[model samples]
Target: MMRIVTAGYSRHTRSYYSNQAHGLKYFLVRLQTEGFCQALVNGTLYTIRPGDLLLCKPGDSYELMVQLGSNEPPSGDYFLSVELNEWMLEWWEDYKQEVKLNVGVDEMLISIWRHLVYEKRRVKDSNPDIMDYLCRSILLHMNRLISGGVSSNPYERSVSNQIKMFIEKNATEPITLRDVSTAVGLSVSRASQLFKEAFNQSVMDYAIEVRLSIAKERILIGGSTLQEVSFLCGFANYTHFNRSFRLRYGMSPSEYRRQVRPQ
Candidate 1:
């Protein structure tokens, strides 16, 4: 059985989540109950809605946004953290690494989440064995859903997915398009062309997107200085970071930080 780290519900209004894998240690499972959200996993984007759930292995950077305009309403969801074991780790390697997997709409799963959260809130007052069993149940069910929905040629698709995952995992490093090309065992043109066909974006552009997403998340969570955030996110300097940030997001990093910070 897996260890239940933490479980809670998140309610957001006109909000967004930008997260990096820099020092993450636990595997994560999140369930969406309401509103619309989009998640970028390994350079590929997924549009998430009610009844959607996602699983992220350790060291995978992901960005989630609730496409809420000024008049849009709030969204709610539940998320849980758990310790990974050898069995699950082995399972991940075999399955297609699709982070945003769907389990359809199931109220039974929601009930399990509620029960887990209630137990988490109870602390030592709760039974560890029961919590562990519930947590294992969720993981097993999600893994089953993902495994059961496999594509016909996962071995081939996994190559493209591996390329995207490599970029996301190493986005903070000073890696080049050539490095990505070589890592994928494709020629420069082939790698670039294949990536474009799959993601509809150039490899370099996706790398920049990954870096910027991680930078935003770091600023919000770590509260690191602008220069530090830029450097940590693989920008050559703050000026380039500022320019890219403004171009990609229409707001400077500092301004966005202030917007998301508590008032």
Candidate 2:
């Protein structure tokens, strides 16, 4: 089981300082969504900007400062602290989690973080199961963002990243290959080949992956039926969504919901 101790968005207009000299008690993940701030990460002070991520483990020294300069914008970030269970411990050890990373400001990533914050605000009504899954989703998504740039050529990497960003933002719409290629100023064949080489998957295949991920989040949040979720997530119909969901998750959406939700 996963446990998220705290999750929220913070916006600081005035200066703010948080010094944790005694070390952190839980895993801390913070993403600078807007403005800028300085943080002492791993004994080095760094200027954190939009799209910068900070990952800190327990017993790590962490400090954050927001000192606004003349006409400087206020600092804002989405932050969460997690109490690692056995599974999370394993996942953490599997990757060499860096203190800071330049993961771009991805809309889908922000959406997931927003959902986690909203669910946390539910307090007594909040479902721990939902929080658990959302936190896991966020960590996994961050990992993917960190490792997605597989190309060594700087131009190829930039183009591939642009294609991914386009797909992420438009996956909920009825987007096509041509749209993706056009967004990145590449032809269909060139964009397709670039994305496949960079991510080891076809463009349409990656689109389905994004769709199913959105559907899963909606399904877990409830209120909407399976068919509605399918359409809302850009699936052609329930049948296709159901088949894809099963193929990826090994169970139908309903079964997944039942298993993960509180009875």
Candidate 3:
């Protein structure tokens, strides 16, 4: 089971305050919807603008500094944090190969995110399954553009097609490197290596990402409880779900529901 947790949006007002320099932390995916900020990772400065995404790995020294840009107040920037658990690790691998940071938001992703924002606003408590489904879809939509490049390498194209088919065929099953290997007619280790090379993710890692993505939908839209969702989603137990969910959202499953539920 992939034990990932997510943190929802909580806006922070910045008047040019400096955060204390800290050691490396968990993976940080910064989505800039408004305003601009700069992140200094080990003396290298990177600028962030609207639609830009930034990744920060744990244990890496970094600092976040925000300032007022052309826009006044800059209060609408959205920042979310999710711990990169096993499933995320796989997603990251594929993502690193296929997607580039700071790329403009694809129309599909924009639509999904708009829906998520709308849903989040109306519900005081959210169904864990629904939240998971929506969030996972948002993430995948962002990655799909990265995966669908114009490259013509036969091997890369093959890998991409296989992955797509695999995801569609087994949306409800636990995806495994071994399964991909068998489907692709390659040794397990060889399959892992090629997948990492072409998609920037091991077969197992991508599998977890797919499973998590589907589980989120099943739980949320299917109206399944955490236990049922976990069991059906390929998690070993509820404890595993709690840990992963907390890490990804910065709140437990129950808390997420309470936070998103309409009063």
TM per candidate? 0.50, 0.66, 0.45
Candidate 2 wrongly placed segments (more than 4 Å) = 151-162, 168-178, 181-263
Candidate 3 Cα lDDT to native:
0.59
- What are the lDDT figures for the candidates, one per model? 0.75, 0.87, 0.59
> Per-residue alpha-carbon lDDT of model 1 for 1-263, expressed as tens digits?
66778898988886777666353477777888778788776667888776677777776667777767888767888898777787567656754456765555444466777888898889558888888878767767655444432333333333455567679878999998889888878888877776676567888888999999999899889658989999999998899999999999999998998898856
Could you tell me how far off, in angstroms, the CA of residue 155 lies in candidate 3 after the best superposition? Answer: 28
After best superposition, candidate 3 residue 220: deviation in angstroms? Answer: 28
Clashes of each: 0, 0, 27
Against the correct fold, how does model 3 do in TM-score?
Answer: 0.45
Give the number of the best model, judged by lDDT: 2
Task: Put down candidate 2 lDDT per residue, 1-263, tens digits, no spaces.
Answer: 78888999999998999999679999888999889998886688888988888878888888999998778888999999989678778767755456777776777788999999999999579999999899989989877776786876545765787788888888989999999999888899999999999999999899999999999899888999888999999999999999999999999988998987868
**Superposition error at 192 for model 3 (Å):** 39
Off by over 4 Å in 3: 1-20, 69-76, 95-100, 114-124, 148-263
Model 2: lowest-lDDT 10 consecutive positions: 90-99
Q: Considering summed lDDT, which 10 consecutive residues are worst modelled in model 1?
A: 148-157
Per-residue CA lDDT of candidate 3, range 1-263, in tens? 22224444434465454453575546555566666677787567877666676666555566777766554557344433456566667767755532116534334555565566555555577455655566678667656644563444544545555654565577457666677778767787876665677666655555556656665666456467767877776666788767866766577766655555534
**Candidates, ranked, lDDT:** 2, 1, 3
Distance (Å) between predicted and true CA of 159, model 1? 33
